[model samples]
Target: MSEHAPVEPGQVLPATELVRDRIARRWEGLNERVQAKVQSISGLDRTPEVRLIQQASSAGTVTKRVSWLRKAADHVHAGAAHLAACRKGCAHCCHIAVTISRAEAQVIARETGAKLNPKAGVFSMADSEDFGEAFKQATSGAVGKPCTFLTEGSCSIYAHRPLECRLLLNLDDDDLLCQLVEGSATNVPYLDARQHHVASVAILGQHQDYDDIRNWFPQGRANDTPSTQHKAD
Candidate 1:
């Protein structure tokens, strides 16, 4: 899921095969145009993506890199706008885990003056099998909770949100399957933006570990962030 890093004890992502399998299943159902677009995105060169990251790195700011990611997301969204389930005021995806790098958390904390939760590692999507039952319980408990920055059915930090949040697009035709409910599963189809995820990791730094957004802005509110006048729609 991350760009690059030396494999560490608990950092290795779990369920890679499962995600690929799911992508295959989703691919089988996409419309021809959508299928062609997905293939085009998948067929893009990996080297150029890394080069783009290097260029962003040379710009000397994580925000710039993240902004580039947002633009990349916009391009993706534009191509699939007709079918993407994601739209303003529809944020069912925000209720689940949202990962961000430490540097991203720092940027958000600095910009919004939001006190970070300080608790780390517990909410990472990486295989937390080593953390035992506590991790499992926390993962389950986090599923239906609204993000700290979610307010009035919108994200308070939409302009400066994390790459994980930016690239999370539900390719379904509508929001029905994206709705969250306990004891039920959803078959939402999303692009496998692994190349971009890797680029994101590279831009942020390979050494930085990922954590959930709740851990980054535990008590922050829409009003606590940039004044309404400054917030982006």
Candidate 2:
């Protein structure tokens, strides 16, 4: 089959199906790994800080969730070393729109000592007739506004970043494709369509709605207090 050939309705592509299956299996193991990690941390140390870590890990705090996601991403990356191009200091893809659940946002807020504003930076492209143009407009202002957590070209809250950020793994060889100004297309392998659903379930034990990452924290600055007015794009 041609690499660019379209699959007909009701047809299943072998490669696509295999990727989906692999992601599904990895997602299924997240809970087990979380438990194992928590147990190891709890048993290997007996300090007060370690005890606090154990408690938080068992309760599925952002720290534990981040650890689980890192492990899961690493497992998937290990199998696709030839396809993955994500690396530290490569912040090209960070300019795009990022949405996250309320739970995840609250965690970030707590960790960063920032106020959580539910309505800030809200936007929806569901009604757009021209998706590309709509996306461009929606993200135009954010092109240079690196994620609030980004400092010195690195994610300051890397471990506690949103699930949307966690799932972005580029499968193309050209890093330029990740640039906001670049029009080139890039491959995305090992992507599970149900990733958001799984993330919501794992984080909040059910489906949770999302908002833009920029909206979660207060405007004016990363650690600023939230305002009463809502900001939308």
Candidate 3:
């Protein structure tokens, strides 16, 4: 596919199905092992002071840069080289507030033929000490739910998933602590990829406001493509 070509549902949907199947298989393979280990850990810090790092957006056409960011992040995840409790079906992390740039959402919409959820309003969020918690307070209704792209415990747009999703890796031994439920509030350590997140802000190489993924893509894939071509192209 050309870098500028609109992403076809056919191109992505079949792979999405395969991804779901793999996740299910992996989940089934480890369900008993993970469950057995859940009771042993207690330090799942729910209120980790998450830092929202920001930098001036950088330059690139949508495809090359997004691909670069993902590949780099994948390399980081691989080099981190620890077996994580995170598997495809274990999507507790997906339920949290995920932020993304408009460029990314447009790219995703165009690629997946997913309709863009028009923003109700536009506003800027400065880098905050507690970005997630701050977002939770400002938009009382925005988060604490599964990402729209998630389906049946697997990510429908896994390959085209945003940087926020890609970099948020849990470096724990099991899924027990990452569960966003009672008693698991203890901090679960994740791969230190804060620099990548800063790059995520800078990937587009232009100043753009970042917003929640669901705001830009509320639910469901569609035949309708994003009309604006990301407004970047």
Candidate number achieving the greatest TM-score relative to the actual structure: 1
List the candidates' TM-scores in order: 0.67, 0.50, 0.61
What is candidate 2's local distance difference test score?
A: 0.47
Question: How far does residue 171 in candidate 2 sit from its true spot (Å)?
Answer: 1.0
lDDT of 1 by residue, 126-227 (tens): 435544453444445456677787765566776667667766776655444455534544456675667777766666675655667776677875454432
Ranking by TM-score: 1, 3, 2
Local distance difference test, candidate 1: 0.59
lDDT of 3 by residue, 135-185 (tens): 555344333466677665567777677776666655545554344432223
Q: Candidate 3, overall lDDT? A: 0.53
Q: Local distance difference test, per candidate?
A: 0.59, 0.47, 0.53
Q: 1 or 2, which is superior by TM-score?
A: 1
The segments of candidate 3 whose C-alpha lies over 4 angstroms from its true place after superposition are 1-59, 120-134, 137-144, 182-186, 223-233
Which residues of candidate 2, in runs, are more than 4 Å off? 1-82, 121-144, 182-207, 218-233
lDDT of 2 at 60: 47
- In the order shown, the candidates' Cα RMSDs to the true structure are 10.3, 13.6, 13.5
Show the colliding residue pairs in model 2: 120-215
